[model samples]
Target: MNNYEKVLVALRRVIRATDLHSKRLSKNAGLTGPQLLIMRTIRDLGEVTIGTIADKVSLSQATVTTILDRLEHRNLVYRVRSTQDKRKVHAHLTEDGADILARAPEPLQEEFIGKFQSLHEWEQSMIIASLQRVANMMDADDIDASPVLDVGAVLREDGWKETKKKAGA
Candidate 1:
């Protein structure tokens, strides 16, 4: 195969791997990949509006609303109208939702995170940088790029921070 075709094939493989992992996660956790992602987003950003969730998850607002509808119907989540802004609705996890979220299995793709962590620091940086370059070549927008890739920083317990210490504040 030509160089371009080979690259396309590799990209397709990565996409397929992601899809397969999501399906496995759904079967094991009783939550689809997107649902679990949304729950985690809600946990991180409490009482978030639908638009905010959509933005955080890189999904369209309508898609998030549909997922929220299912979550609400399952009694895993509930929406409350903002008292000061009647037109705004914020989504919060119900007790049942929290319970489910607590028990939900990690995504199969997360295995990659563990493996990535096992690699040498330089190896990890190289892999991430290569992926970021590939993403840029594919015409992914600047906003869609991961901060971790852009800044060469890891999401530590304290949050996203540069790996290298700056000379001064």
Candidate 2:
């Protein structure tokens, strides 16, 4: 296979692994991957704004708002308008939300964190560096306050170019 095709195959494996893990996490914890991630962020940051949550979760503002809507409708969180700023809405966990957060599952697909924690510090660092290097080779950028750089972003940019060539981004 060509280099690009080989890379595509490897990416498919990564994506499939993530999907499988998300499904398992959902089945075991009753929370989707993204929901669990948001819960953990809320637990860590206490009261936080939607924009902060979006940045923390590596999602677009609009996407985070939609997730927050679902979370709010499920009574997992509450939105409070800032008394000082009025226009600022901060999301706070409810009692139920807190309980849920306390029991929330791990964010990583596998018990990678647990396993990594068990490794020697140097070993862990090496593995992380290797993975990060691979990610960099794939052109994945840092998530927060940086450019988007997942397969989705690559696809979007390339798709736009292809479409423009065909018709007109």
> Could you tell me which 10 consecutive residues in candidate 1 have the lowest summed lDDT?
149-158
What's the true lDDT of residue 149 in model 2?
A: 21
- Model 2 — which ten-residue stretch has the worst lDDT? 145-154
**What are the candidates' C-alpha RMSDs?**
10.9, 6.6
lDDT per residue as tens, model 2, 28-110: 76666666777777878998998998798766666567667777888988899999998889998888878876776566633
Per-model TM-score on C-alpha atoms: 0.60, 0.61
| TM-score of candidate 1 on Cα atoms, chains taken together | 0.60
Q: State which candidate has the highest lDDT.
A: 1
> Model-by-model lDDT, in order?
0.69, 0.67
lDDT of 2: 0.67
